[model samples]
Target: MNAAIHEFTAERLAGGDQSIGAYAGKVLLIVNTASNCGFTPQYEGLEALYQRYRERGLEVLGFPCNQFGSQEPGEADEIASFCQKNYGVSFPMFAKIEVNGDDTHPLYRYLKKAAPGLLGSESIKWNFTKFLVNRQGEVTARYASATSPEAIAGDIEKLL
Candidate 1:
C-alpha cells in the first residue's frame, strides 16, 4: 500500500501538527466530516466507536470538509471547539479540506484512488463519506453518507 495515501503534515483540529504516517499499521476509518450536514451527528457514534475500541488498534480520523453545501463554515478553532464540546470527539481531526475536484487534498485523492466509487467514479458524493483502511494501509470498504456509524459496528468489531 505504499504511496496509496500521499504523505501529509497537517495541524490537528485539537491544536498540533500530525503526520499521516503516524497511523500506519492500524485500522483507520477516514471520514470527510461536516458539522452542519444531515449526517453531522455521526460524530457521536464515531466517538463511541473510537472510545470502545481504541485500545484494540482502531483509529478514527476525521477531516472536516465544507465543500458540500457550506454545512461546515467555521474556523479551525471553532471547528475544534464544536467537536470537543458537542460530541466529545477525542479522535484526531484535521482542518477543513476539499475532498473532490482538481484541488482535492492529497490524502483524499489517494483514498479515492484506492477505493473507487460505483462505476469507477472518483468523486465523493457528499459529506460523511467514509473510507475504512485495514492494518496494511489498504482501503477495505467505502461507506456512503447515509450509512450510520452504529450500522457498521459489527464490521469494526471484527477488525478489532
Candidate 2:
C-alpha cells in the first residue's frame, strides 16, 4: 500500500474516524464532491458504478467539499440526507473537507501529488475531481470533474 495514502484518516459522515489504511487492498475511486454543483447529478452515476463493482472490490469514497463556490455548504448530516434523498448514495461519504488550500486534507494532498492534473498542475480545479487508486493504494489516474463516472467504468474493470 502507498504509505502516504494509508497514513491518513478521515471522519465518516456517520460520526466516526476511519483509517484509510483499512482500504489498503481495495480499488478506490476517491472524489471531492459538492452537493450543489452542476455535476451533482453525477452522484447517480457514481452510485450506479459503485453498486455494479462494489462486490468486485471497488470502493467509491465521497468527500463533500464546499470549497467550490459554496456549493456543498451543508453539515455532515445534511449532506448525508441530500445524497440519500436525491441519489440514494450508499457508498461511504466522509465529513466535509477542504480539498484545496492550506488546510487541504492529508489524503487529498497525497492524491494531488501522486496524480497531478493536466500539464502537471497539482491543484484540484473543481469539485467531483476524482483520483483512481489501485489495490495497492497507488493513485493511478486523475479524472477531471467533467468526466462522467460511467465513462470510467471500463478502466475500473481493468483494475479489478
Candidate 3:
C-alpha cells in the first residue's frame, strides 16, 4: 500500500468529506465516470459488482468527471439523482472532478502515477477508466474505458 493514497480526500456527492483512509484494507474499484457518455450504462455493472462483493470488503468508488465531451454536466445533486434513479447505485460517489490535466484530483494524480495506462501513459484516456486497488490500497491494475466492469471481475476476485 502506498502511504500517499491514504493522505488524500474527496468530497462526497451527498455532501461531506471522504478520506481514502476510510477504505484501508479494502479492495477498491475506483472509476472516473461520466453520466452522459456512451459508457454511462457501465454504472449498472459497477453497482452489480459492488453489491456482489461489498460484503467481502470491496468498495466501488465512483468519481464523476466532465472532462470527456462535457458528458457529466450535472451538479452534485443531479449526479446523485441520476445514479440512484437510473442505476440504483448504492456505492460511494464523489463530486465532479478532473481526471486529467493540471487540476486533477490528488487521489487521481496518485492513482495514474501508480498505475499508468497502456504504453505507460499517466493521463486518463476517457471516462469509466477503472483502477483496481488491493486490500492494502496498492493499485494493482488499470483498465481502460472500453473494458467492461464485468471483464474485471476475475481480477477483483483475486484481490478479494
Candidate 4:
C-alpha cells in the first residue's frame, strides 16, 4: 500500500472509521507516539502546534504505537487520559498501529514511502517520527523523533 495515504482509512480513537480524505485541503502532521518513549514529551510541543495553527489549517494526527519497545501499552481510555491530562492534547489520535514491517498500517506505509527517513530508510527508527503533509495531501517533509516539534514550526508555518 505504498503511497496510499490518500486512500487509507483509520479507525478513530473517538469511535469509528474515517478516510484520510477527511483531512483533504489541510496541512497534516502525522506522528507515531508512545507513552513511555524518551521523546514522549514531544506530545506537549505537538499540542502547542495544534492549538496555534489549527484555526489557520493545520491538523496534527497522533497514532499510538507499541511497536517501539512496548512504550505505549495503555488501553484506549488510558492513552486518551494520558494525552489529555498531561499535554492537554485536543487533536485527533487514532488506534495504535504498526508503523513498519509486514503489518504496517496502510496510512503509515504511504507516509514512509513518500518521505523516507535518514539515508532514505523506510523503517521507523523510533517513537515520535513525523510526516508533514500539505493541503493537497502530499507528504512534504519528515522529522525524526529527536527533531523536536518546535523545530518543525517553520515548515508548518510555510504550509499554512
Candidate 2, residues 7-82, lDDT tens digits: the string is: 8999999899999998888899999999999999999999999999999999999999999999999888899999
lDDT of 1 by residue, 119-138 (tens): 99989999999988877777
Q: What does the lDDT come to for candidate 3?
A: 0.94
- Summing lDDT over every window of 10 consecutive residues in candidate 3, give the lowest-scoring window: 1-10
RMSD (Cα, Å) for all candidates, in order, is: 1.7, 0.9, 1.0, 2.3
lDDT of 1 at 58: 93
Expressed as tens digits, the lDDT of each residue in 79-116 for candidate 3 is 99999999999999999999899899999999999999
TM-score, one value per model: 0.92, 0.97, 0.97, 0.95
- lDDT for 147 in candidate 4 is 97
Alpha carbon deviation, residue 28, candidate 4 (Å): 0.2
Candidate 1 versus the native: TM-score?
0.92
lDDT by residue (tens digit), candidate 4, 1-160: 2234667889887779978888888889999999998999999999999999999999999999999899999988899999999889999999988998999998888889889888999999999999999888889999989999999999999999
Error of 3 at 84 (Å): 0.4
Estimate the lDDT of model 4. 0.91
**Candidate 2 total steric clashes:** 0
Error of 1 at 119 (Å): 1.8
Candidate 2: give the clashing pairs.
none
